[model samples]
Target: MTTSPSLLAAQDLHVAFPGRHGAASARAVDGVELDIGAGEIVALVGESGCGKTTLARALLGLVPPTRGRVVFRGEPLTYSSRALKAYRRRVQLILQDPTGSLNPRHTVYDAVAEGLRIHGYGGDERAAVAEALSRAGLRPPERFLLRYPHELSGGQRQRVVIAGALVLEPELLVADEPVASLDASVRGEILALLLRLRADLGLSALVVTHDLGLAWNIADRVAVMYLGRIVETGAVEQVLTAPRHPYTQALLSVLPEAPGDPVVLTGEPPDPSRIPSGCRFHARCQILAGGEAERVGVADACRSEDPEVLGGGGEAQVACHWARAGITA
Candidate 1:
C-alpha cells in the first residue's frame, strides 16, 4: 500500500515550562518527531505524563514549542494572530472533558455556532449549526438546540463538544482522550463516530490516548510515547502485535490477552529535567534488567549514547539501541 502525503509533521519538537520555585524548566515534550498523513488517524499512546497532551497542544498551535517547529501542509506553523486564526479553523482540538470544554451557560446551538461566528461564517448560521450537529451524530439537531450541558447525558455532551469542532469544518482534528470521560458503552460509539467521520469527510486526526485498545480500534498508525519521546511508531498492527522496542514489548506484555506473566517494568520514568544520559528507558527496561543487554552486547551503547528514532518513516521505526538491531528478548 502507498503512503499518503503528510498533512502535519512535528520535527524535533520540545516544550518546556518553568519548574516550581525558580527551578530549571521541565521539558514536557522532548524531541518528538511525528507525522500525521492526510486522511489518516495516528494515535499517540502512552501512560499519563508521557507528553502526549503537550504534543497535541503544540500541534494545535495552542502551546508554542520551546525548541523545534511544527509544520502544517508543507508550511512551518506560525503563531501570528492571522496565521493562528486560520490554523485554528483548519485544525480543531477535541478536549478530553466535554463538560469542562463546553461553556455551561451556552445552549447547544450557541456552542456549535460560536466557531462560525468567530470565523465570520455569513451564510445561514442556523443551517450550518444543524449540519454540524447532524455530522456529529446529534440528529434532529433542532431537538437539542435549546438544551444545556447539564441537561444532556455524558455521551450527548461529548457529541456537542464534537459538534463544536465540526462546525469549523476543520480538515484535521487533535482529540485528547476524546472518549476517556465517557462510559464504556459510549466509548465504542465515539470511536465508531471518528472512524465514520474519517471515511465520510476524509478528515485526518492526531489522537492522544493512553488506551492501546483505542489505537487498535481506530488508528491507522500508532506512535508509542514515553517520557517525552516516541519509543516506537508504525502501522497499528505492526507496533501493537510485533513491537520492536523493549518498552513497547513490555507495554504490550501487560495486555489482557498477552499469554503468560506480564513483564512488569520497574522504576518510574526519569524526571524530564534530569533525563538519563543514554537510553531514556534503560533504567526500567526489562530486556536490560538482568544483564540481557550485556548478553546482547549493546549495554555500552545503551548506557552512553542516546538513540535517535531510526528508519525514515518506513512501515515502522523505533528509537532504541537493541530495537534497531532486532535484539529484544
Candidate 2:
C-alpha cells in the first residue's frame, strides 16, 4: 500500500532563547518548516550553530517553540501530560554521544530496556531488548546483555543507543549527529548500520548533521540551514549537485574534492547574533558587491528584506531572490 505523505511536520516553527534584554532574542530556529514521510530519510545540514539541534529538540517536544506547531501523524502536538506521553512513545531521539547519553552504571540490557520499562512494557521487556539489540547488529544478545557501556567499543555503544530507541518501536527517529564522536572508519560503519535499519524496518528518519558528505551518502532529501533558517531544500541531487542559494554554494565550495579540483571559500560565514540586514547571507555572498544598489532581481529587495522560501526549478525550494534570476544557472 502507498503510505501517507508525512508522518511528522514542522510548520513555520520559531524557537528562540533569552539574549541581552534590549537586543533581539537569540533566534535558534527561524520560521523553519519541513516534513518527514514514512520510510523517508531527510537530512538537516548546516555549519555548526545553525540551529539543527534546536530544530531537532523542537520536533521531539523537548523544548516548546516560540511560534508555529509540530504535528505528528496529522495530529497537533502539545506539552500536556497525556500528549507528552503519547508523543514520547511514537517519536524517539538518538543522541550523538553514546557514552554521554548512556548510563555507565547500567548494563547494556538495562540501558536498552529502560525505555520499555518506562512505558510499561513489563512482560515483553526481555524479548524486546533482545530483538532491539539484534536489530542494531549487537549479536550474541546474551553476551551483550550483561556488558556495560564502558565495556563496549564506540561503535558498539552507538548501536546500543540505537537499540534503546528501537525497543520502543517509534515511527519517527531523530538522530542528531549520531556518528560525530566516532573515528572516520567507525563513522562509515554507523552510517551503514542506519541505512540497513531503514531498509529492514521501514523507519522514517531525520538525521541532523554538519557533514554534507554524510548527507549526500544517505539522505533522500537535503535541507540547508543558515542563521537558523533553511536557505534551500530539495532532493539530494538537486540541492547538493546544483545548489541555488549563495549560502549553499559557499558551503559546497568548501567541501573536499578530487586532487585536481580544490575547494575554497572566499570568506567566513556571518555571525548569527549580528546577522546582516535583509539577506542573512549578503555579508559573505560573492554574488553581491559592497554598494551597487543590490542588482535588480539578484539584489534589490533580497538584500533589504528577508525572502521566504520559494519553489525554484525542479523540486527544490530556495530562499534566494537571485535563484530565479539565473544566478545559480
TM-scores of the models, in the order given: 0.96, 0.92
**lDDT per residue as tens, model 2, 266-329:** 5666655566778887766666753332555456676688887532112578887677666543
TM-score of 2: 0.92
Off by over 4 Å in 1: 20-22, 310-314
**Residue-by-residue lDDT tens digits, candidate 1, 1-329:** 11998899998898998899888888898888888888999989998888899899999999999998999999999999999999999999998899999899999999999999999998999999999999999999999999999999998999998999998889999999999999998999999999999999999998999888889999998999998888888889988887888887877788898876898888788888888888989999877777778887899889898998533242678888876666645
How many clashes does each candidate structure show, in the order listed?
A: 0, 0
* Stretches > 4 Å off in candidate 2: 1-4, 258-274, 290-297, 310-314
How far off is residue 56 in model 1, in Å?
0.6
Best by lDDT, which number? 1
* Candidate no. 1 TM-score: 0.96
